[model samples]
Target: MADIDVLRDVAPGVMPAYRALVASGELYSDAAQGMAAEKLQSLWVKLRGYDPQPKAAGQNGWVGKLLRRKQVDEAGEHPNGLYLVGEVGRGKSMLMDLFFAAADVPRKRRIHFHEFMQETHKRFHKIKADPAVSDPIPPLADMIAAEAALLCFDEFQVHDIVDAMILGRLFEALFERAVVVVATSNTLPDDLFKGKPGRDAFLPFIALIKKHLDVLVLEAARDYRRERVQGLRAWYVPANRYADAALEEVFGELTAGVPAGPESLYVSGRKVVVPLAANGVAWFDFSALCGVALGPGDYLALATHFSALLIDGIPRLSPDNFDEARRFVTLVDALYEHRVKLYASAAALPDELYKSGEGAAIFERTASRLVEMQSEEYMRLPHLT
Candidate 1:
């Protein structure tokens, strides 16, 4: 690793030098250097249960595809990059990291989706606000272009309308500037905005993605989280001096104290609040929640603020409840993707959440996802800790 860092700094700007170093195999390679690379490496290590081995030529698999793409790109045709999609715990991010580390791109930038969006949003707003700014988009686009010939994004899911609207323009700018994009996502490009109302508005963005990139699915059936969940019977709770302090800390972290007073908590511009009953139990009206309007951006905000979550009053959601069920599913999906620890006291386990009629199938699917969320392996340790 030390040798690779030195090599990265000292090597002349040529492909043969990198190829020679990689062939010599003296430096210990790692995917942790960049965000995308780290994500890919983590997934690779998890899936293989060990560090990756060198590949043989003509090997045709995920590794092969990536290597082949790297070779083609090295030869200087078009930007040969990959977009990896898969189920949770399938190691899409890990694979991406390996590719980034092994591939010899002159410049590269790997970013987490939320972090990248926040930065882009911040930059865009700053540029718009500056009176001296002229042609902000081109310079900003060129800046990103200059910094990275290859760009990798992790957890690339789209639920926010604003993000959806801008993605087209952003990608358009990126493509025009000839930046190669590689992303790891749980959803397909077409299905990205699934279930978002009026998502047809973003079809052009979807089209642009299809036009610019090749998409691959990693279909290996293993659910790594399932093993982790079964291994750890209970969620981790911090030791506290007092139970009340612990409770307050946990609840505060989860809710961000969105004024649990008389007014309802605003989600996506909707007025929905967590209510405390006579018994002092907290419950939220899932049906009235607006993740789309408030945007999935808040999910990152909430994640940044909280380390642990205890969702109570879920049992109150009736069997026939569709809207609440959908909301719960979305929440679970987002939380799971963020690797958040979840604890809930429900009237029934996920299996019993929907035992009744017509909505049973969808409820069952949601139930399966919920169970996956509880898997001990799936839970990620808090970043702060």
Candidate 2:
């Protein structure tokens, strides 16, 4: 297990790491974050080579020197970092971002945990193409350590057996190289991979987390995302100029007036163009979404990337565009399952969106889901990715 020593400064109120958190004004002031910032400040001091004491050997001489060398080696090889866990929108990720920006390490990287796992999967696949490579995890972990001495991850989660099985070995190697990690997650270490099929096989990974990292829970009671959009209009009707303007205004409120730009995303090797994306939300026209030849895979990928979607000009479905209506159904299912917030300007209500379409009977379920998704309950659901 990695060793930890409690550190206390002479002045109890000096908190260097809370600067960003206070400046952002994104959350209410809380003692939980202030304490976390102090811990992070201690880590930063160590990473900056701020140790003051030097060790001296006793009368045991060479024997004592050998024992001390072994201890030093072991301590040098193990990770010394922080693992932060909390519920959704408690500002765990936000705090990690502040700490990462303030850390003075020569090589550090902060990334979404899902994107890191995706890259890891890609690396393993590429290595496996060479039949001689039996186990690729060690080399991949080495590559990761070579790239970054400090790794900061956002929204870490484990749902699938593939990720669950490999994490133990991959992280063991990382810790052995003294690669520090700071991660934020919605779930605690013990609860990761809790209900999956090969859960027993995943236990060692949880153990590794406890051994190598200091786990802290953010105790903030509020969900900041919900607070931000609470009581705001979610659905617009009639597809008129006023509804269009309202949709745009809602987008601005959610995104804080950030400029939207196009992004190309890949799903099953298929390229999907998101025309307007900013601040974790994407905006799309009806034709760009339902009018194209797309499937559930593409829609699922969209849900994975964005927290919310603003779709404009959804027309009343008809028999002529039955295929588009089918795609729309698939899209709604993906978004609903992932709890991606939906903001739309449609020709009519959810029940009336496809009243007389070729697939009207099949779309009853879709309309029902659309109606449910606009509720306060659905908006409060946490995002899967």
Q: Tens digits of per-residue lDDT for model 1 on 171-260?
A: 777665556678877789989888897698888988878776677777644543333233433222222234234444444433322234
Candidate number with greatest TM-score = 2
lDDT of 1 at 48: 25
Superposed Cα deviation of residue 112, candidate 2 (Å): 2.5
Q: For each candidate, how many residue pairs have backbone atoms clashing (under 3 Å)?
A: 12, 0
Clashing pairs in 2: none
What's the lDDT of the predicted structure labeled candidate 2?
0.75
